[model samples]
Target: MSTMDKGTGATMRQTAKARRRQAILDHAKRLFAASGFRAVSIEEIGAGAGISGPAVYRHFGSKEDILAELLVGISEYLHAGGAEIAGIGGGSEGAGGSEDAGASVGVGESAGVGAEAREGDPAGVLRRLVDFHLAFALGEPELIRIQDRDLSALPAEARSSLRRLQRQYVSLWVAALRRHAPGLSEEAATVTIHAVFGMVNSTPYVVRRIDTAVVAERLRTAALATLGVADVVAYRK
Candidate 1:
């Protein structure tokens, strides 16, 4: 093969390998989300991924490594996704980004909301964030479950990395919120951002009593109000 052809073939091989690796991770997510991380076994993950147990180790050294990759990968994914939502160097078009974010977090699309906020549309930016994260909370409740209950189970380095990514994600919200409410201080905005996350993250528990549309609307409004947008009507739509 020509040198460039060889390079292309090698790249294809790597891509194929990564796809197989992700298949394993996808199955592990379902198993981990359905059963607690501790309850899930390597052999089971292998079976779910249609691979032998020994083959699983070729992709991941151990079960903990898979879990760590899952948690850390999602954290990194969320941070990157939030960066795009907040317009941090994310240019106007962001469709491919939408898919990557949704896939990494084990959620589907965010209703085609990859568009950057309109010029002079600060509320638009905030709305984008609210809409995006609400979709995540609703669609990936299992991942959320792992985040809330099993975070401490991760190895120390992974746990720390996860926390760091989470904090960066919150900063994206804080930056966007400041545009809507200039009076918001760093500390106040941080608190508001954290509280809003807690509010939306409650979706899994409350989905039974109310329609998701209603839940999403209430959260968007409440989050805007929390950011001190007194007239949230303009933004809630």
Candidate 2:
């Protein structure tokens, strides 16, 4: 065979291998999301992927490793997306200013507080928080479900690393909240941030029961309302 032909054959073989690996991960993610980590096995995943039992081991060491990859992969995906959004000038022009206007309105109706609390524009931060969660949650529901449900199955050391990544993700939200709601204590902001996450992430499971178009609209409205941005924009006058 010609050298060029051999090179093309090698490339095709590698592509096929990569596709098989992805197929396994995709099926495993579905199983994990439906049945949780403890109940799913590598053999089941391989069977679903139409691969032999031993072939699964060639792609991943074990089920825990697959779960780790899924969780960490999703975290990394969101982190990268957030960085991209942050770089794109807060997702769009005028978005930051509009967010600030909303925060101002929120402060006007609240109880009296010191100047330190007023330094950060809480409304703008809340808008970014909503945007971030909506982007992340909507992009990867299967991965999110695996991360939330299968995390406890990871080994101690692996769990520690995963926890750090999870904390970093949380810190991004907390920091945004701190900037927007300067008067709010960190503890208070943390709780609100988690609440926002709960509302955003739960949409996937809930929306699946409805039509896709309706689900998208509901998600957009719910995210904006939950983050208090809707009120801010409405009260801008």
TM-score of every candidate relative to the true structure: 0.77, 0.73
RMSD vs true structure, all candidates: 4.6, 10.8
Worst 10 residues of 2 by lDDT: 104-113
Tens digits of per-residue lDDT, candidate 1, 78-190, equal 66666766657442132245456456546664334335544667777777777677777876777787767777779888787778778778887898888788888989988
The candidate that achieves the highest lDDT relative to the unseen native structure: 1
Task: Write model 2 residue lDDT over 39-150, tens digit each, in one string.
Answer: 8877899999899878999988888877766665555444433433332223212223323321221111111122222455555545554555565566567767777777
Q: What lDDT does candidate 2 reach at residue 226? A: 53
Candidate 1 RMSD to the correct structure: 4.6
The lDDT of model 2 is 0.62
